[model samples]
Target chain A: MIASLALLAIGLALVVVGPRLAGARWTRQAPWLAILTWQALTVAAVAAVVLAGVTLLIPITAVADDLGAILHACAVSIATAYAAPEFLPGRLLGTVLAGVVPVWLLVCAARVLIGGWRARRALHRSLDLVAEPGADSGGLVVLEAAAPAAFCVPGRTSHIVVSRGALNRLSRRELDGVLAHEAAHLNGRHNLAVALSEILLRAFPRVPLFAVAAVQTRELIELLADDAALEAVDRVSLASAIVSLAEMRAPAAALAMAQGGAALRVTRLLAPEPPMTAWRHRLGAVAALAIVAAPLFLAGYPALSAALSDLCNI
Target chain B: MRPFGELEAAIMKELWSRGEPATVRDVLASLSTSRTLAYTTVMTVMDNLHRKGQLDREMSGRAWLYRPVRSRAEHAAALLQNVLDEAGDRQEVLMHFVADLDSASVAQLRSAVEAARRQGDSAPGDAG
Candidate 1:
């Protein structure tokens, strides 16, 4: 029990501190909330792990004897992971974990970073391919590719890149609709939204829910972009653009275009919004919160105490 | 980014579960497990979400077909991001998120960035 408490404490501390370091660059909409959720969920997850590990590692009676030792190590790692560095001694476990966990987190960050980089590069290529600098061709830049497609690459250096195929496949009005949709991505920073899902994947590998979040977020991003496009273009044109894009060849990640056969995207394109997505996101938020929170506190009292202390003390 | 009230949320939930646009009856049918929702209430909420730029409404023969303007995943991602940011407690959580990332991803991000750099002579902020 004591050992579990110690682990719980350590886990709680990570939840409190991890986001500040890792989720800082989330760079999407609701920057703070996203990081905090990740932090809360991640910490809760780690606590569950520790709680389970301790349960398996130490017998009930034997937990007391190891409490001090576990607490010390926990303190060491938490301090190393977050403290001023001068505060804690560089112990072996601390060093190992300090090195390992961040590297683990980099897994998610790496995707965004790489994708962002490739996107940046691809943006340049697209720009060069089109020779349009803020040409305002309705915020759509025709790329040199042959397949009709669209996607929104988010970031400060973001763009709604399109290909010749997409332009050719889609009528001028449909292309205009596609451009409007892509513009919405940049304006809404859907890329950042997808990035959050990516981070969730890294943090929660065991839970397939993260993938669900990814899928849902991708669809929502499209919807939000579609809404934005609707502002600048005609609904029918936008709908047709989505339908045609759905029927066109798939494009790269940054380019959110209508693929030839994205059934769901096609369905959404054919239909418009009502109460479905909003509530689904809400439920996801609730479920995600519960799943994330339950694990952290799975140790019952130990996890509860740890969380209370961390929040109160903070 | 705020919670869209439990009622509106419930209505949206119904639509999302069906994976398509729905009417008041459709929303109501899926929500039968919950409290009773007025037909007008569902109508109003979907109309509200539609106005909020969250839902898309299309005219049908006599009524409007309601669909999600955004997918559940997209909204959750956005909400998760918001949840991450709620307290501005950047003092710790950020580190935890970053620290948890495995090295392979870190290297990948760096490699991608490096590749991007190589692909274009543009400065860090100006990729154009």
Candidate 2:
């Protein structure tokens, strides 16, 4: 029970503090590390909460060497815990936390994945009709729109799409930069990373951490892609391409939520900063690992100590 | 299998350019100038497109005459509209190069890029 409470407390603290930690200045300089940290924080929080419930259902006294004996002890502990009036409420809460949370998460994940897949397939079908293969644009499907636009549809057969307006507005070098940016997105499989954050946001809309992480993930991904594009094109060209593409008109409602990602990206590109030092990178990786492992260690400590004592007696 | 997609594109292009209902034989003749395709292949592709609702078919004599449900420009406009409408909501479906910025932000960013370019020109060695 004490371990379960400790785990729950850790989860709550992480939910409150994770966003602030991720929003630090260092994230812009090292987006890959930042993305890793964000993923670790989210996974740890979910694991902590779920483990808290499981630890409640299975008391430390239920620890045993064999599977059968362990199961028997867990069954007896749960039955006795429920039978006692004093423990009934805690047990009920545990049942809901352990049983309901995972199932709810799974349902939400399914909805997001299936809905995203259907939407992508439909978009691909539309592309087949209205787009033609570009002549020398590196296999990009050229759409016949006059509005400057560019995007990539990711799937087994991913396509980088650019409109005729973009072609007309951008120089050859600028267009190459844009294509490189979209290629970075597809090569890195950034879609899956974004989807994971989206799932959490959908599952718990009210949680500040999930909400903040979703927005941050989207921004970081654009930065990451820009960084990749730098390898193939000059900063000036890429920055200009970003500026040209920003001419697209969005709805008024979305303008309020827009972070002006283009501005941030262009600034970073123009005055690039040195990446994190080797030692700092190592420190960041270790911190991410610790965040994920802390909950598991907290929930398992009691059982681990009990087993150690049993071995000593033997 | 990849060529099938190209063939579908060719068939659609042929139908749209003809500006009238065309039989499978008519499409095959226009397409044969570029590459030889079996008659059954053209028929099967058109049949699939009709099933997918991209084309409408009517009986002309003994054969089905196929026409695009919408014009090429209309399809292109609808595709662009769909993309812009869903851009804000569906991040997983597509990764746009840059989200559309308001006019104010666009002006700010354009100037920023201009400044960067001026700085780069001063230091020739720094340009990639």
TM-score for each candidate, following the candidate numbering: 0.43, 0.84
* Candidate 2 ranges with C-alpha deviation above 4 Å: A59-86, A248-258, A311-314, B1-14, B17-19, B23-66
Reproduced native contacts, each prediction: 0.00, 0.63
Question: Candidate 2's residue-wise lDDT over A1-314, tens digit each?
Answer: 77788889999989999989655888998898898899999989998998888777774344456656755555454434323223777778777778999999999999999988977786777787778888775659988887667999998778899988778888888999999999999999999999999999999899999988988899999999999999999999999898877755434424455566778898889888888898999999999999999999987776666544433333
Clash count in backbone of candidate 2: 0
Best by TM-score: 2
Docking class for candidate 2: acceptable
* Candidate models: Cα lDDT each: 0.49, 0.82
**Which residue window of length 10 is worst by lDDT in model 1 chain A?**
A252-261
**Stretches of candidate 1 above 4 Å error?**
A2-99, A107-115, A133-138, A144-146, A199-213, A233-235, A248-261, A276-314, B1-128
Q: iRMS for all predictions?
A: 20.5, 3.7
